[model samples]
Target: MTIILKEVLESEKPILRNLYSLYLHELSNFTMNLNLGEDGAFHYEELDDFWRVDGLSPYFITLNEKTIGFILLLERPFLKKSNDYGINDFFILNQYKGKGLAVQAARKIFEEKPGQYFIIQVVENKRAVAFWKKVYTGLNIETNERQDLIDKELCLIQTFKV
Candidate 1:
């Protein structure tokens, strides 16, 4: 299973939008704020900002040439912090979970874009917290972790350099 991280293009925004809808639906299980719009679609107002914003990136995670997930990368000036980058959003289709694909994709991104980084996981999302813990351990990277409230949800924030 060769994994590829392809930068999303303007013409392919719709594809990402569709995938994001599914991602949001899945996330609704862990958070209460997500809802379908009047158009019956999950709206992500900032989806287009990836193209317009200087430091935002949208990458489609493809395996064997099929898109299975996506990663939203936030960098430098885009974020109001000294950290080099942040993983704004990451999702793999439910069908693709539990096969170590997420970890490999994450590792690939971190390896390619080496710098100070931070990751946040809602405290209620045990799987995501464990996933990040596993990634940190597997890579043997030291991490600084703390609990914080974000959007009224308690979240575990991990900071480290890659």
Candidate 2:
């Protein structure tokens, strides 16, 4: 499959916002256990907050111009001095999962967006932990894997200079 990761444009906000609900729905499976809003909406307000964040780059993961997922890459990693980038959020639709599309998209994104990367996954999300391990390993680079304490919580973080 030919996959592309294009930076989300302001004119595409509605399209991106539509995908926002799906992204959050997929993440509902996380340890965070998302709960729907009263109006049955995914409360897309968070998207606005993320957009307003400095150094945050949002992309629409598309397969032939059809949106399938979204990725929020933080140009300024949380641990400022430790790593230069971060994946604040990432999600692919259920039907698209396990198809190796993400890994391919990530490779392209990594190539286009270069930096010392830092990725943090909640310890309880074994799927994320496993997925990232595979992605980094696929990168064929030396990575420093460690546990990090962020916002009074423990998370598994991998740091690597790409």
Candidate 3:
């Protein structure tokens, strides 16, 4: 499959917002921070900052001209001093998993953004850790890993340079 990372435009923020709700729901499986709003939908307040803030990017991962997932990339002063860039959020529709599409999409993003990178998986989400490990190994990149706490939740972080 041909993977494309299309930079999200300001006018497309609503589309991204919808997909982000799905991403947050998936994330809720491992983190306790998710809660439904009065509208019975998940919400991400800082999502709008991707457009307003410098170095924060939101992209739609497309295949065959259709959006299959979304990726949020963070860079520079927005993150901790350890890495220059970070994969802030990534999600592929459930139907698309295990076909190597995610791996391809991730590789494409790494190619587009070459620098020291940071990726984290909630420690409770073993599948996420495995997925990142596969992506790193497939890219032939070595990583420095450690455990860290964010919002009182334990997470596994991998740092690497491309």
TM-score of 3: 0.96
Instruction: Tell me the deviation in Å of residue 76 in model 2.
Output: 4.3
Instruction: For candidate 1, list the clashing residue pairs, or say none.
Output: none
Number of clashing residue pairs in every model? 0, 0, 0
Instruction: Name the candidate that leads on lDDT.
Output: 1
- Kindly report which residue stretches of model 1 are placed more than 4 angstroms away from their true locations once superposed: none
**Least accurate stretch of 10 residues (summed lDDT) in model 1?**
24-33
Residue-wise C-alpha lDDT for candidate 2, range 1-162, written one tens digit per residue: 988998888778888787877777765665354678897867567667455666778898999888888888887633367667888788888788899998988898888878888788878678878888899888896788899776655688888877
Residue 59 shift from truth in candidate 3, angstroms: 0.7
Error of 3 at 155 (Å): 0.3
In candidate 2, stretches whose alpha carbon ends up further than 4 angstroms from where it belongs are 76-80, 149-153
Scanning candidate 2 in windows of ten residues, the lowest lDDT window is 26-35
Model 3: clashing residue pairs?
Answer: none
lDDT of 1 by residue, 1-162 (tens): 877899999899999999999988877778888888898888788988889988898999999999999999999678887799999899999899999899999999998899999999989889899989999999998999999999988899999999
lDDT of 1: 0.91
Between 2 and 3, whose TM-score is larger?
3
Worst 10 residues of 3 by lDDT: 75-84
